[model samples]
Target: IEGPDLISKLRSEHGVSVPVLMLTERRELSDKIRAFRSGADDYVTKPFDIPELEVRLQAIVNRAQGRPATRRLTDGGLTLDLATLIASREGRQLRLYPGTRKLLQVLMRASPSAVSRQELEHALWGDDPPDRDLLRSHMSAL
Candidate 1:
């Protein structure tokens, strides 16, 4: 993804539930850290073996699909219906934008721990990234 902002938009707007695998030639440790902080589940350096990538993709998909997963999560006054994408607090619906909904889902899943920025960006933008400033604007608006 080239546009940092678009990536942010996707993370904030779409309820992307899968892990993002970054396929890139950049191998610097700093780059890796940036990717993870952006919300990437895994980062594969370029010139990688195809077989290994396939296996990794499968594993990520399986985990995301809830193969051997736990059900239900409740925190504070909110209850999340993961399967149905419904979240409510005290039987009252909490209004949310599309991006906020996705953000909530990720945050709820990673409760008590900080979700990486890279992971969030990947979930939002995929391979075609957007401008960072634009993303920041959207987030602020949200």
Candidate 2:
């Protein structure tokens, strides 16, 4: 059976308890999408880098074991618990609204990297995004 078929079988039998990473020779977008739709956690094509593959396997294991790759991100006096969506800075708890919390999560994950306004909006609301500079409002609250 093919990789996607195998993934579908595993998902049906185990119900997502097993993390499936597809390492295949097919590099087409349709093939990748089919694997994901069949319940693959990750996919890598042929001629892959060993280090990158190992990292992806570790990430899948972490997710399957109920341990996030980064449970809490700490930089100086700030901390954000990714699992619980709790955040604090300088020994003070922050009351983050839903939009603000999402924005913070995206920003924290892309720390030190410049995130475009368009990317932020897409992250918050894909395709049918809000009009105007509404992301600014979320940023202010954050």
Candidate 3:
């Protein structure tokens, strides 16, 4: 969860309905914009006040809970339904194996970047060591 991809998974796969409050020391405007674009609801720069941070988080949580339901997800030409875990690209439903489906979901959520082999293995196998060809097979199938 400490890795960069964690945020995307939290937002996309886990369906975290609450706002995300990111705490970072980065001072650049581009960095802040990137964090927001990557699904952070709010970014708190470093050297922050604990009380202020708590208050902001509380406000965000309250507001999110009061909002309407969200139904659809679209990334580029691909669309997915969070309720059904169904995905389609360019109006065609992509047939995917169960494992491959899960892998695709993770990858799609973290699109425009490469997800490390270790991250995928951990997601699919947990703490146990998976078969050497497991990921390769899944990727190929995908």
User: lDDT scores for all predictions?
Assistant: 0.66, 0.80, 0.71
In Å, residue 136's CA in model 2 sits off its true spot by 1.2
Model 2: per-residue lDDT, tens digit, 26-109?
Answer: 989999999999998999998997546755775788788888786677767888776566789997888988788778767876
Those runs of model 3 whose alpha carbons end farther than 4 Å from true positions after fitting are 1-73
Q: How close is candidate 3 to the true structure, as a TM-score?
A: 0.47
In model 1, which range of ten residues has the least summed lDDT? 1-10
Report residue 94 deviation for candidate 3 (angstroms).
1.7
**Residue 137 of model 2, lDDT score:** 84
- Pairwise TM-score winner, candidates 1 and 2: 2
Candidates ranked by lDDT: 2, 3, 1
- Best to worst by TM-score, what's the order? 2, 3, 1
Q: Which candidate is the best by lDDT?
A: 2
Report the lDDT tens digits of candidate 1 across residue range 1-142: 5422334456668855457888888888987887776667788987987545755675577688877433445778887665445678888876666555556666776788987867666656666658776546545643
- Worst 10-residue stretch by lDDT in candidate 3? 65-74
